[model samples]
Target: MVDTVSEGGAPRRGRFIVLEGLDASGKSTQVDRLAAWLETRGSHVHVTAEPTSGPIGSLIRQSFAGRVPLDDRVIAALFVADRIDHLTNARDGVLGFLERGIDVVSDRYVLSSLAYQSGDVGMEWVLHANEVATRLLRPDLTIYLDLPPAAALRRLETRRGIPDRFEELERLTRAYADYELAIEMLHEKDSIVRIAATGTPDEVAERVRAAVAGEL
Candidate 1:
């Protein structure tokens, strides 16, 4: 399982960096920029996101699109399943990349599950369900782009022609509150770095880079 070996014969592992925020918080853009910056420095960077393109992820997308009507518990379960697959898939998984000393920059991870799912199901249940994934794939650094729900909704309306089920202002507001509660409950105050996502992409990317400077 240990694939990375230092020049002095000591074991070393790559960093797992996760970016989390509400929809339209510019996470996707920042993740791309961060990965590109790391690759330019000769690092082996593997970039990915949640609701992966796997079978389970397809179902989650269907649920989001209203093509598949599912209970809250069922939807939450699907998220957990997709996460496990995302980490363990043989061909292209986070674990494989990390094992080979390739750093990972994920747009969204288990925290997204906690924030979004808690809006539908209670926070306690969502927390319990995500316990295993938390222990297994805990990010070395979590950058949370803290954007107000109203601003995020405006950004979504201006940018995306269509919004997903959870993109509405009301639902997003609730999810945002859930994110706050979950962050506290998970005791991520130290590991999770919050950045103001109100500025331009360039400005925000600079903050993101500064936040992860020590880890890199």
Candidate 2:
């Protein structure tokens, strides 16, 4: 018998995989590794992220650069709007890949909205808004990178790139706490798996691969 516990109305075709965490939790490394491995094994895998590359996604990215100072509520709504475009726009290619039996992996998803909006607005409001935004688009497997706030900060300091607006804040401690709380909420619903992200990128990637492989 198939597991009918996933969201999105008794589950449609395609497996939706999500990697969630704080800014420097090494989610990108793990996601890339997992996608490569899946492709190597003959699985059609497509890897992407939230704040995607669509028109709305471009605006969201610009907003992060301080070019667009939308209110917290507006930011949340914009994320949902961008997600709609990401999921539906034929040019975006996520739905197309999924339709072709390619597993869709994402760097962040609704969880990011929950953490950021909840930190700024409130958890209840974030949840309510997301329920409307995400309607039936939910992940089948959500791998959460569980890392200490201090470690995440260290990685951010050493990484070679321009930091976004959120990266320069002391809010990471609260963000880490919020992610942990969100993980707990997902765990209670049996929809999330926490991978310890306290080691090298390869180590974390292996752990994530193992987690996904076990589920498969």
Candidate 3:
């Protein structure tokens, strides 16, 4: 239903696959690898990420970088606006690509907001804010790169000279717990696959490939 449409004589849409993980869990790297694999298998691919380069998304990044101080609730609200734009904008929006039969692989989607925002505000508030089932386009498949918070922190220190506001150990731990809850709650509707993220980037990509093969 999500990755395909069979109604109103519309063209067959491509799959919307999402890669989710805490900071430094190799999400960006895997997004590339997964897209490459899908292309090798002959599926046209479009890769994107949340906190897009759009106006609203730019504001969100400013907040993440500590350049713009904002309340947690405010940031949560920005995500909703950013996400809506990410999907519907005619210029390179996700729906535009998918509607044209090009597969879309995103680095993060609604699940990231659900997990990270809920860590700051309660889950009830985030759920009420997003209304994901109705407002956002749920991913056809979400592959979670499961890594311990401490390990992710280690990577952050070495990979980036300065950590962002959401890079704390406590926040990362809470986000992981939130991910578990979100996965359990949406498994039936979202078709999520959890792969252990401890290993080389190529190792994790292999697992991601296996999980995606099942859905394709």
Clashes of each: 0, 0, 0
- lDDT of each prediction vs. the true structure? 0.86, 0.78, 0.87
lDDT of 2 at 3: 36
What is the RMSD of candidate 3? 3.0
- The local distance difference test score of model 1 is 0.86
TM-score of each: 0.92, 0.87, 0.92
Which residue pairs collide in model 1, if any? none
> Which segments of candidate 3 are over 4 A away from where they belong?
1-11, 132-136
Q: Write candidate 1's Cα lDDT for 37-89 as tens digits.
A: 88776677899999998899999898888888989889999998899889889
Candidate 1's C-alpha runs over 4 A off are: 1-11, 188-190
Superpose all Cα atoms of candidate 2 onto the true structure and report the RMSD in Å to 1 decimal.
4.5
Ranking by lDDT: 3, 1, 2
Give the higher-lDDT candidate: 1 or 3.
3
Worst 10 residues of 1 by lDDT: 1-10
- Tens digits of per-residue lDDT for model 2, 30-59: 889988887777666788998997888888
